[model samples]
Target: MPENRISRAKLTTDIVLAGVFGLMSLPFALMGNWADLVAMALFVSALAVRRLAPAWSLGIAWCAATVQMAALRDLQFYDFAVLGVLYSTAAHGGRLVKWLGLVSAGVGALIATVYLQVLMPIFGDTSGLTPENLIAAAFILVASLALLVLAWTAGLLARSVREGREVRRREEVANRERALVEYRYTVEQERNRIARDMHDVVAHSLAVVIAQADGARFAAKTRPDAASEALQTISGVARGALGDVRVLLAELRHREGGAPQPVLDDLGELIEGVVAAGLDVRRVETGEPCELGTGHQIAVYRIVQEALTNALRHGDPGAPVEVRFDWTPTGVSLMIANRLADAAGGPGTTATGATATGPTGARHGITGMRERAQLVGGTLSAEPGGDGVFRVVASIPAQPRSTA
Candidate 1:
């Protein structure tokens, strides 16, 4: 692509140079006088090399033509060559070159008209205009005006094309960057879906198994029959949890509609699983319950689950976590807070809590949580609490875009 671009640039430069010099050589090439043959030869040769040296080619062509007119001692019809040089310089050269080329052309025309009409006639009638003069003058004037307009218009068009190409290149780069951002977003969303499913399955399953094991351990000597029943319940809960996990894993892998989508109603089961783990939770609700869209409900459920999980990880086991939901006039607000138990801190060691401990709390996890919230036009915060408590708070706007 780079080589091709360089080649095209060279070709465009050659075309511009050729057009400029072709005009410069126009007047000398039009003459039929035998003495003008040498000048015409020089002009033609310069035209061939114009692409290599435009200014030199144009200047040499104009000078040779002027010299030939001087030698003939007849400047008649030479004004056309000067006009051609002026147009060429204006189209291809810089501001100074354009001004000088035009001034020289205008002066040359005035001098040629004077010499051809007055001075040259002292030797002989070399005016070359009489019966044919009016028609020749009209043709030259019209042609020069037309060529000048054409060259200026062509230069404008070339500039516009260059600008348009540059704009398109920039837009193409921007589009590619936008596509990459969207792809990364999709991947992250899918990964979050998988992670939420894993937490739902594993955490709940472990809770039930641990509860049964604790019960079995306590009852092993005195209530052997109750211990066997607890073991049976463990088997039942494990099978059920495994089935749920299998369905979730299948959905995560996108195995052709493996499970029905879970919504707000399914949150009760999630809460029950944590309760079965012997964690004390108090859930308070406000406003009449209404069916929410699956995606919104899923976002809500995940936010709540994450908050509760953090509570379990950081709060003392004996402390109760409070879960509150309020559907306000503007949006929904969810808050989870748990008081820390004094026993959680070892002697001379302060309980820093999970928020300060691991990657999930300090690094990528909170960032991911915030991302999920923002994706649904919501806001989330995790902060230290005075009086030995930690809080997780989130607010999700109702009719998301309406708030925006």
Candidate 2:
């Protein structure tokens, strides 16, 4: 498609050039009578409106030229006004206009050179073909060709500038789109991470509280003292849940707040707490003492805690649960696996202080655990083991992890 804007701009410049050239030619035309002066004025006035309508301007200039030629009975150098019109047509007009303008410019130059050199040879008495006249004709032809080349070059430069600006605008828009996409991706990842952490916290805490509460209610008649102890354990578990939640909330505000940091070393105490609710837990380790960072230590502690809670809820009652921690040269690895229950546990009941089943298979609890492991530059996998047993295994690097 043609660029109307470029066409319009070139047309405006054409009109201005026509006006300046026409006015400059007036002094020479005015050496004649009042008729000549008035005609020149009218002709120049028409140049101002060339851009308003290019075809009309060409007609006007042509008609004025015919009148001027008639009154003078000869053509002068100023007869080249039509050349300006031709250039405008080639530069800003249609394809048909361009071809017509080029032909007209060439033909007009030829006729004017012939007329000036042969018919009206004012410079010399001899008017026939001569070396001087031939040289003048050659120069005029060359000048016309130069003008054509100039107009074409100007048009190309204008088009190039417009395209450059357009390309820059597209690049800016692409950059903005890329930034927006990255921002959305970061937000989604963060939301998933928070969801996983919340699932682990709520599921483990509620499971422990419920299990203790159930045991307390059942033993109230047969063993009143044991039942009171179960109640006390439930209260302690609830308080600990509150503390855990508070610590998590503080973390959201960029503060750890001197909260008690749980680590692998605390596994025994954690297991004892569950056993206090009348559940059996067996702990095992396969590594020497290793110093772990604060955040990673908490992460490892939570992993083991969540696993034991899961076993309590779903594993065989009175069966054994194995908790293993292996510290290797590369990193620390944790595994928690329990013997499966032959008979399904009661709904929402656990003597070990845990839920009978997790939120559903595709829910966030287990998925959260896996993500937490990954966040610390670790890997976690949970699935069915042999003979109805479920296993949760995690390997987290001991080196500095990526905070992001």
Candidate 3:
């Protein structure tokens, strides 16, 4: 049999019953009514263990019934313990035990009738009953059986009602849990949308400004004319970056609507901006361009944008950042790699020049990149190499929208 767990409330109820009914038995015990005293103990045991061990409670009640009949003790008010036992049996017992309780009810009524009519006359004072009083004895027997059946049947009905209530309560709790889960999912979706917009605006624009500033420094040494041209590029790029940051900030202040996302067509402008800032960077593209959906295109653009941004912030300025794309009919594969900066850090300066977690540590930049990949039905992993190279690789799956 499986073990049934009982709650603290139920155990407390059993303890209370044992105390109340155990004390109630004292009156009978003092009167020298051994049968009533014994019945009291059995009935209290039934009440206490009804939920915990219903079968055992039923057996104890039956033994109490036998003692009362065998002693031919006159029925006392405490004899109501029989009805309490019968009710508990139906309410709490298993299938076999409930049926046994019903049978015990019938047998107990028979024994009660026999004791009142036959055994009392032989052992104790008969009072008014005699062998000649056939009609009276018959009436008594019928009424006793009726009350016994009523007690047992009442318990069965009560059990059915209690079980129905329990079933309804459980369903209510399940519905509440499902609603909570759906609400959390909706909140998460909205947060991700806001995050994607902010990442695109901040990371891409700053990468270009940093690249231009670096180039101006290098050109200032060799050619004054070239240095002047680099300075102009830096001024224009910084204004554009500032404008993008303002737009993202506005979107953050009012979350009801969203700003436009970027796409693959923007890649050239993004890379050129990086080159103007002055990093040694190269771009490689292979295979015919496959048409990607807006969401997938945004994912591809943002991932590349973030990778390039990180490269400028953490890569050695003298080393080249290789951005490569291997496009196929089904998907686009991207790889970006550059030599990681030594403990000295990169030569680029940004609006937020905080690179404490640069190439080797944790940063929000990596998290945003990974989220973008997942949004596009892809996987991304960026790892720092033992050989001082940091590489980010991603594969984004897409199907031609005409087929979709």
Candidate 4:
């Protein structure tokens, strides 16, 4: 609809311009110069289609000049329309027409010089080709050519400016599309990180709470004090889980509202919570600890949390879990092992009766852990052994802190 409106407007503008040119040439029609009137009418018609059909406009202009030369008439005011036709050919015409406009400018200038200087005087007077007349003719040809070429050059400049604007507009659109794609990619990555954090926090906490609650229920009548301690552990674990959930929700609501994440120092509290849930955990550290960047630390912390959570959920209740960390100058290696709940294999279980941690088994939790390890330039593996034990081993390389 808008395109239609613009086209109508351009057509209206061309009609008005043609009308004005015709009105200006009305004097020739009134003066009874029939040939001049005919040429003016043709030139006016060319002006009407100057932009809409530049090739046709150029043709009409040549016909007007031919009629005027055949009558041996002097250049009239409406003859200026030839300049407009040439300009339109360069500005609005296709490749062939644009070059043709230049050729027409040169040839028309030469022809006009000959018709006015030689042919007109031959028919109207007895003047011969004197040196002064020849020199004047040369000046006239140069001037006419310069004027026509200048008009064409102006049209070419306009074309260049329009094309440049079009190029800039396309570049802006491409930049916007690129930025939108990057934004979506960043958003997806952040969402995955949040999901991993939520799983680590909620899953571990619920597992501990469930164990404590079950123990409390079984020991309530036999040992009231033991039941009370179990209830306390459950309460603490639940409250901590609630707080972590609130923080995660805050981060969801406001991108920059994330709380400080757990680091290596917080592992002690993690282990203590699991122990209070009635699982025995043994920790062994070998070699000196090395510094790790924030991202690497987060990866290490989440991997350990997930591994311990899996053991608490799937391992034998009476068996002790072992966590070993071997640190070197470059990085740390971690191994966690626990006895299986059942010694005989069954559905959803390995040969050792431990829950399968492969893609088809405990997929989500193990996959999350593996992704975290890889994010920090590390590797992780989880499998159940023939000895009825499930093991998780990871090697994480230290990374340098990023500068601001």
- Best of the candidates, TM-score: 4
Candidate 3 is scored at a TM of 0.58
lDDT of 2: 0.65
* Regions more than 4 Å wrong, model 2: 1-130, 138-148, 218-282, 288-302, 341-363, 371-379, 386-388, 401-404
Best by lDDT: 4
Please list the residue runs of candidate 3 whose C-alpha ends up more than 4 Å from where it truly belongs after superposition: 1-81, 93-100, 117-150, 160-205, 213-260, 265-269, 275-288, 291-295, 311-326, 335-358, 361-393, 400-404
Models ranked on lDDT: 4, 3, 2, 1
The regions of model 4 sitting more than 4 angstroms off are: 1-6, 29-34, 124-132, 348-361
lDDT of 3 by residue, 1-404 (tens): 31235787996898697668778766775585667778767777766776677777778777876777777777765567677678867877788888988998888777777777767776776565575655656777788788877888888999999999999989989999999888778666766766665666666666666666666688788987887887788678778767777776776566554666677899898888777666677999999878888888878888888787777876777889999999998888999887766623345322223345543322577777788888778999887666667788998897555454
User: Residue 321: error of model 1 in Å?
Assistant: 3.4
Worst 10 residues of 1 by lDDT: 1-10
Residues 51-153 of candidate 4: C-alpha lDDT, one tens digit per residue? 8788888999999999989988887788888888889888888898899999999999999999878888778765766677678789999999999999999
On a 0 to 100 scale, what is the lDDT of residue 63 in model 2? 70
Residue lDDT tens for model 1, 16-69: 654565456456546556545556555544444333344654577667666676
Candidate 2 backbone clash number? 0
- Number of clashes in every candidate structure? 0, 0, 4, 0
State the weakest 10-residue window (summed lDDT) of model 4. 1-10
Pairs in clash, predicted candidate 4: none
Relative to the true structure, candidate 1 reaches a TM of 0.62
Question: Estimated TM-score per prediction?
Answer: 0.62, 0.59, 0.58, 0.89
